[model samples]
Target chain A: MNLAFRDIRHNLGRFVLTCFGLSLLLGVVLSMIGIYRGLVEDALTLARSPQADIWVVESDSRGPFAESSRIPGDTREAIARLYGVSAAGAITYQSVETKYGAKKLRLYVVGYELDRLGGPDKIVAGRSIVRSHYEMVADRRSDLSLGDRVPLGRNMFTVVGLTENRVASSGDPVVYLSLRDSQELQFELAPPAARREMARDEGVPGINTVNTVIARVSPNVEPDLVAKAARQWKHLAAMTQMEQEIILTRSVVERARKQIGLFTAILLTVSTVIIALIIYTMTMDKLREIATLKLIGAPDHTIIGLIIQQALAMGTIGFAFGALFISSVKDYFPRRVILQPDDGLALAVAVLLVCILASALGVRLALKVDPGEALKG
Target chain B: MSLNGSHTLVEARGISKYFGEGDARVDALREVSLKVYPGQVVGLLGPSGSGKTTLLNVFGCIVEPNTGWMSLDGEVVYDEGWLRSDLRRLRLEKIGFIFQFHNLLPFLNCVDNVAIVLSLAGFSTTQAKQRSVELLEYLEVEHRKDAFPAQLSGGEAQRVAIARALANRPRIILADEPTAALDSARAGIVMDLLRKVAIDQNAAILAVTHDEKIYDRFDRIFHLRDGYLDIEQERGVTEMTQD
Candidate 1:
């Protein structure tokens, strides 16, 4: 019989309890990893979803996600006429909070020309936005069903379609609107603010500002070359789609990544310490048995195997428990928890290594036990 | 003891052991010497500080004697220091130990407790199990083979302990106080079992004990006092002279 398993079998209740406790800890670690991945994925979604080859924004700006970058809405026309430009559209982005039913909801609003490159990549339900004004495509996370009319910026817009996994870097669900409506919503001041501005004789600029002018390059043309051409305009900062994604990750969500990574490291350290203490305690509990084992001439490897095997079993079972628990309830979390296969595999490997390292304490204690102790009492 | 010297299973000569140093030093064993032959159940009788257990540890390959000549199954295993690199393997092959408390692994059932020894000796699981069952059956505890250590009575646990000791068919069995925890009747039964095991397996049995109730069961008894062997008590019991 495998002695380690026999010992576990002998004390199954305690073993299971220990594993359950460990699983919850591991679950938190896994969730942090998932949340971190989700944060980056969310930050990159809008940049990637538009499927543009190049981005033309305000001069010297990393926007539209990392910072504010408002160019004239007419920049789309200039970008479209540029050499090698296949398609171009000006899009505006803003975060809005509004009352829906009795609940307050936050949303990320994106405005794009109907025939342009920027739009929700997929409509999982209902139809795409058909009207230039008063029609919207909302992410399912917003709980806006088809035909739901949500008031926004002095106008009511009907939800004509629904999307999934489309959210802002801050995790607010994204909603799509026609460029005309979005400009009105994003740049339009409240009636009182507008009146005050008019009374002060400061003429209200027309609501014609867009966060970014996204362009698709011709298949045979290099997007970088097109971006370089746009940058020569000096008043406009342009970047290829890859560069935009880099900015989003590095500027928009970098701190969150570092924070999550630090928390994960801390949790893993705590887990290692907890596992070490637990193994040490378990070894201490069985010191006599270990002594007897030694007295009976069991090999050092056998003793080491017993401790390491127990640690590994605990870690494996705990990881499975944590993974399953997190997977079953991830949707309930406000932030997306994306548990990818690769992440799980990596975590499993990490847990395996951690278990081995943690078991060192127990193995050391066990190896140090004097066989003569068994002959004592 | 001068048994047939050719059949001596375990022999220790001038085995001197000390603990600590200087003012705090203790002579746990002083020039102790003895020999046990196959099929003999030998008992070392002594008081609490008489060093019986220490001597047993030395013979069991647990403690390295500061100075000694030791042999098991006619092979020199320790001379002043361990002659073998792996004392554990040497012990596993030729020396079996039975603790006073029947230190069978609490987690393993009686059969596994016994079979683990054979397994450590490199027997296949099936072979180990088969041998363990035969040993348990021989000791009349086959019915309790699946019972864990806690479930066994003192006598039953000791019987299982004996079975484990015989698992690898070691040439020598060193039991420390095999019957100290047993009642007189139960102690007699355990002693009978040990004697039976010794004769049946042709293994030498050296046991340390303070219990005199089962004293008659041993084929030869040696008394120890103040780390010195009572050669007077051993003289009438064996033909070999203590050096």
Candidate 2:
């Protein structure tokens, strides 16, 4: 009964071909959105897993995630002495390449106090790093199973615990180590340098330094107040957990988000133009038919409805196909592609809006066709 | 033949239509006066650009004439270059148009092409389709009702279009070169069908064509030359038979 559906059915092959092209374009757009979201999720997972309310870093620094901020490991005790600070732990983060078997595995090595507010939030396998040295907990994505021995700088550690989906914003799997061993490994001096320093009457080698100190405020006290109180220490800068996340997302990965956003806008604009051109061409092909309809006294709204109905159908069909395509092959992608249902719904709505906007060109062309053409035509 | 006599269904007096502005202007119709009576089939003949199409447009209420007094179904619809009501609604409710080509919607089948007019007139889909079947059967194209416009033969397509024009049961039917695409035999068939429809429904019909073979089929004929009336003819039954 609907003219749009009738026309599409009449030209089923061409309609399907157009929808396929649209679906491929929509699939790429959806993947970009997923990549952007996945980066944000990866960034947040590590921040949320530690469950610390505040971070205390070296003075005049943005913290370890955004920039290097090495402070004395004893800063944990200073932050723990504050009134509302229930727990504090010195933490270090560094990217390291370790050998699994024959392949090199890149990991985000996180050194945390085992008894304090830093470690994996959930353990799916054996146990947390129990030994003070030569013990590790690996994320499942690292392809390391429990009971495997991995060699890092100057030591071989046994993987005792396993976690899943714990990764850095760069998509590297996270591996946990005891705070002491991590600090020693991160700032270890080469044997030659150590002997040279000894001959030159230098002090002890760099061993007791950590990237930052993480703390959790007592439930009754506001974390912001504790952070502000800790800021009074001239040797350190204290930030609440929310502030650290803002820094990570807004400053640390700001450029990536902006580039992806620009690409998304260009894709959407291209989609709109392509749809307009296709619909306009379709209207042109039926110029005489439209003129005849006009001469037969068809209302303008009816003609408009034909164009918009076709547009809306194409958009809805294309979005459905795009969502299916991205979800089915997302795992094959090197980086995580997280497609949430809300984002899919939002994209569907956007596609519909674009379709409606694109149909305007066809509607304008159809309305401009003079009914008088049917007389001699 | 509802009253067994002539009753005016459409009247146009001194209707003029001009295009462009000033030095570039050209008059398409120059004070063209015309009448169509119920149960009659009128023909308009002219060479190319002689204003026959313009006059049809004026009668169909598609283009406003520069100067005109037009009445339809006893209502003063157009007076001196303006419409008294919505022209689109007037055309939908009271006038049917058949073009040079069949002009059937290519996407729709023959039945749907006819039923669309009834749907536009506010009939439910089921009612419109039922009425469309009856109309196509009346035009002797019931067997081709389910075929798409592209699938239908030329003669069949024209019959479907005529059925569509009559689907609204309007008081007047205006056809422009309706038989131009058909051969002599097919053109005779279409001409006969038009005559039958006008007499059966008591509706006035006006057709513009240049088919000499079908000249005797018209109840009245008007010819135009250089945007002016050139000749008028009305033949008796005996003369029509002789032709």
What is the i-RMS of every prediction? 0.8, 1.2
Which segments of model 2 are wrong by more than 4 Å? Answer: A98-104, A143-151, A156-159, A199-204, B1-5, B237-243
Q: Give the alpha carbon lDDT tens digit for every residue of B23-134 in model 2.
A: 9988888877766678778889989888898888888887888887988876788897555556777888899998778889999999899998888889999999999999
Residue pairs clashing, model 1? none
| Best model per DockQ | 1
CA shift at A279, candidate 1, in angstroms?
A: 1.8
**Model 1: per-residue lDDT, tens digit, A210-307?**
99999998889999899998998878999999999998898889999999999999999999999999999999999999998888889999999999
* DockQ of candidate 1, scored on C-alphas against the true complex (2 decimals): 0.82
Model 2: per-residue Cα lDDT at residue A187? 91
Measured on C-alpha atoms, candidate 1 has an lDDT of 0.90
Residue range with the least summed lDDT across 10 consecutive positions in model 1 chain A: A368-377
Q: How much does each candidate deviate from the true structure in C-alpha RMSD?
A: 1.9, 3.3
Q: Comparing chain B with the reference, what is the TM-score for each candidate?
A: 0.94, 0.93
DockQ in order: 0.82, 0.62
